[model samples]
Target chain A: MPLLKDNDFIDDTWQRLDDGAAIPATGDILVSLARLLADFGKLSNRDGRLGVEFPNEERPGVLESFLPDLSLIALTFPKFADGRAYSQARQLRQLGYDGELRAIGDVLPDQLSFMLETGFDAFEVTERFPEEAWEQAASSISLTYQSAAYQPRRLHVWRLRWARDEGV
Target chain B: MYRYDEFDHRFVSERVAQFRDQAARRLSGELTEDEFKPLRLMNGLYLQLHAYMLRVAIPYGTLSGKQMRKLADVADKYDRGYGHFTTRQNIQYNWIKLEETADLLQELSEVEMHAIQTSGNCIRNVTTDHWAGAAADELADPRPVAELLRQWSTLHPEFSFLPRKFKIAVTGAPNDRAAVKVHDIGLRMHQNDAGERGWEVIVGGGLGRTPLIGYTVREFLPETQLLSYLEAIMRVYNLHGRRDNKYKARIKILVHELGEENFRAEVEAEFARQKELDVEVESRELERISNYFAEPAFETLPRLSTGYEAARAGDPAFAQWVRSNIAAHRKDGYAIVNISLKPEGGIPGDATSEQMRTVADLAERFSVEEIRVSHHQNLVLPHVKLDDLHEVWKVLAANGLASANIGKAGDIIACPGLDYCTLATARSIPIAQTISRRFADLNRQHEIGPLRINISGCINACGHHHVAHIGILGLEKKGVEYYQITLGGSSATDASIGTILGPGFSGDKVPDAIETIVNTYLNLRQGGDDSFLDVVRRLGHQPFKEALYAPA
Candidate 1:
């Protein structure tokens, strides 16, 4: 079985990236398609963290083949209006590639919950947004339904709401 | 009123469940925003300027007192204190958050209402003559057929992904109050030589930048073949309608580019192809659907009201109201009372929450519980007795809904332009208010004859401005609001797009421009009998053009 990592495991990697001026040999590198193609063979680390970036316009089938065993899949949101990435992220999750799905550039604070709901795990959150805004945005709606791509089981909002209404 | 059968109840309940699941998926990261966008649109939720808006389809603008109350409940619970009834016979809730929508839909389902196919590239609410079974001259009530079409087209997999949205309208009245001529598919019930009731089908009529009145493709179509013929038309559109440009994607554009003869042939061919498919147009299914709209429990009463003449003579306001607001009913002594939403200086087509409750009570008590919202921004009590007219008017007036301006100039169809719609360019309600106030003199409006002044904020034509007798199009000229005037448009059986006379005028000059058009019509008309539209059709725009621009 493939190794399963949680938020804690991902946070440690991010801390290392923050501390080191350059990524260590063991550190996983999430490179976008443009950067990967530009640095084709310039940098090589046999066991290093290797991940692929998916554009909104990229076909789901192409991304599905590259997802399994990948350290991370970084999706780029070209603009807020362009909602193609939401489906792309959902498709990545549905294909059972439970590594790490990080949302990179152009993601807005308003769309954070929707992004997370669509199977995006780690967020390389924009610098413009205050840290408090991210917390509030993620927890804006306390309950949700549907089994996400990353989650092991399903959770429903109706039962919780019903129970609350019933004073349970 | 058609009560929800087991099938309808089940359908709506299942839809609610489906939407709940979709919402859950969206929340849990199973369905992304892109995947959920179409899903949300299919359920009539739209992301607007401020927040999401939910448009609830008020099929044919006919609703029971109970249904109206349910809508009022939705207003109180989920949204701001009121709902705006749209031109296409839909109610739009201006303020709706995404999370609250599923609950809202569930609540709507309890009342046998849902917003499915209200938006997206699918067949929208199949609007019919609002008077339907109640209208005096109606050969047959079109609502049953409209409901059948609604059911069949609700989530029909084949046509759901069409190039653009489709609109269908049905009318049985000779006057064409449903505006059938300006729809993708317009069905009018007609009597054949054999006295058999059928439909006069018209196709391609639409309003946008290129407004074209639909041409009669099939003069008389058998009622049984209605679904088959509609399916054929939709198939033709789906297969051949332009998908290249969003602006030119409507079936009207296809009909225009293909020409009527070729388009007719294409539809005929498709109809032939689908003729063998009995699954859709089976007589049993048609009969089953038709039975749902069986005529109401109507009691035959005396032809004349002995007290009506005395009341008319005693009350001048009653007399004036009878002259303007009351329509001829086939059943003598019973009249169709149009309750104008546009009171003097009030916003057009807006009814307060209290007014809605009062209207509901009036419907239950006076009009046999049948109420209709007209395309011209007025509500109709379709079966009020002449004896009850005064009482009905009193109840309506108490609620401030007794505006006796039914087909009058004050009953203008101004869309919720820049005031509410994000799509609007300039405000339309203010212009409508100014015109209604300018022509508030009842005698002058009656003298001007039945003139429709439809104003739209932009070229989207949601206001039906293209088909108005005097159309005002609001444009933003260097951040200043300018109004363009068009002459002699009608959406009736004799449908014609309005003609732009000359340059657009500033907001201040609009009233003068309208006055010039009306005065020119008055000058050029053969007699007082000639309407503004009639005179314009006879003389063309030259007379009105000269009158407006002559050494100004």
Candidate 2:
């Protein structure tokens, strides 16, 4: 699996740990929410950066206390059309978590732009689409109607209209 | 009509290009049918029973002459020389090819139109009163707000993938001509005690498998807080709305399950949080949008038009048409002319390219280049001068666009059921056609007075059968087509879901049953002016049920 971050596929550095897996001494690691809750004391005291793979069904408020110590939060899509993760991502960002937010499972190229807008910075990509397709889909719409979590490349049309009206 | 700004133009063009690529990818087998379905649906392309059907949004039911002409051109070039005007105040071309859709959308974009958000689980087109600006009873034009919502909801990042499709309707008048109470979110304009204008926001109202009238979430929402408040509601619905069952996915179900007070509390809490983020469009932007919908220039003229009066006195046919099709405009010498697409025994809302072109020409000549598509599936020239009524009527009569059945029984709303829709269990058009022919006499229709006979092919209720005065729902029971009747429903200011009368009737027997109901109404009513709806409300459905089921 390739990790899509900022329009480029990169090797994933974080080691995903199962519920009963042994904790490494110093490298970055990802664990499920259950594992994080079960081993909170041991995991928080480690030197490595912490990440949690959150389920779509769980509310983002449950992770509020742990967000400060967490470096990354990966939200599950479960299915492409199932959009619970989009809302979860926004809520997570609103809760002031600015870490790497990744989308995993059933991710497609066409949903990349939306994922970006709703605060997903990294995607666990499958071989369902070519690399070029992902890039094209991400940059498909240069403008959006509303302000969102990731708006670096895309500007809101209202702001554009105002700028044009002011001759900027 | 609202013209597209440079940003709007760019956005629509880029979207077309994107969809063009998507379609190419699908054609090349790079995308599966499942993957392409949502994408195409977002662009208003649906695979119907016959071919692809493309629904083009006429925003707030408003269009300019040039836009109408473009629709006619698309119908002639791409479709089978005709298009169906839908109950959502949109137009659907039935014979669209997948390969040609991009080009068609490009052409539409040239006229400041696109089909984005016409379908899919997104904020669908924002509908408003077709008679918004020209109505005598309206307080303000709702189109500016509708257009604002249109721009805000287009490709909205967080809300584009909701549990189900959302519909928002606005009405500026006290009469509720937009059917606001039957939409997912209904905004009714209100003037407070201090004479300050605002919106009465209603949520959770929808007509589908489970029809529910909306509850007033906010008694009065200020004009500036519209976007933030709507964002809050959408956020709540997006997060809390049911996802397990497709049938219970609408916001109405969430509202129903959580109760109105709980839903409102959640929305208000979300709204408070969302308002802190400052996402609402600036007031200046709203003012800028409102400038586009400013009242058309009108000359100071007398209230009475001698020419119109003389024409009416001299010509009975023209007088009859005027009596039925004309509505009082806010301006002294202006009249709103409703051009009925429902002619005698004709397919309701189906208009040919020639008819479309004729309407465009008439709008250019007499109505200040403006036309409206009503939710009842009719065309309206909203600003026609009273003095020019006769000339307009003459042109309309010549072009087969003049039908003296604006609000009569003949003006039926029928969805393309089994004839074109794959989801349909039985045919809706033929049943509507049969009923229309049964009551084809204009005099008898006028005598019955202002009856809405809405027919849907399936339980999805695309034809708005739940809100009709005499609602007919078609079903397939054991491989046989049967029509279920509901009485005393209305989509007006006093909105109520219709109650089912009794057992279903065969397709051939529906007309007779409807005739029996109408005759029963006439027999029970107080006088000529008492309408079929009035009779139904006064006497209830028992009489109608008995009359319908009585032994012949």
Winning model by DockQ: 2
DockQ of each candidate's interface versus the true one? 0.02, 0.65
> Candidate 1 - CAPRI tier?
incorrect
Residues B1-552, candidate 1: write the lDDT tens digits: 666665567667766776776677688776678767777887898877688889898887788887778878888788877777778888888789888888999899888899988888788988888677877788988887777677667655346556788999999878798899999999998997789989999999999777989989999999888877887788678666776687998999999999999999988976775533344334554566567677656668787787887888898877877888888776777888888888888788777666778888888988888788787867888888888988888788777887767777888888878877788889899998888888888777777778888999888898999999999999897789898999889888788899888899887788878888888888788888888888888888898888888894
Q: Model 2 Cα displacement at B162 (Å)?
A: 1.1
Residue pair clashes in candidate 1: A28-A49, A117-B29, A118-B29, B205-B214
| Clashing residue pairs in candidate 2 (N, C-alpha, C atoms within 3 angstroms) | none
Report, to 2 decimal places, the DockQ of model 2.
0.65
Candidate 1: tens digits of C-alpha lDDT, residues A1-168: 111122221232532122224544565666555554455353244457667776655555565555544667877765453345655665566567788777766665445666766677777654554565466545443333222224422223223333454699
Q: After superposition, how far is residue B228 of candidate 2 from its true place, in Å?
A: 0.8
lDDT of 2 by residue, A99-160 (tens): 99999999999898988988999999997777898999988888877755454468887777
Which residue segments of model 2 deviate by more than 4 Å? B276-281
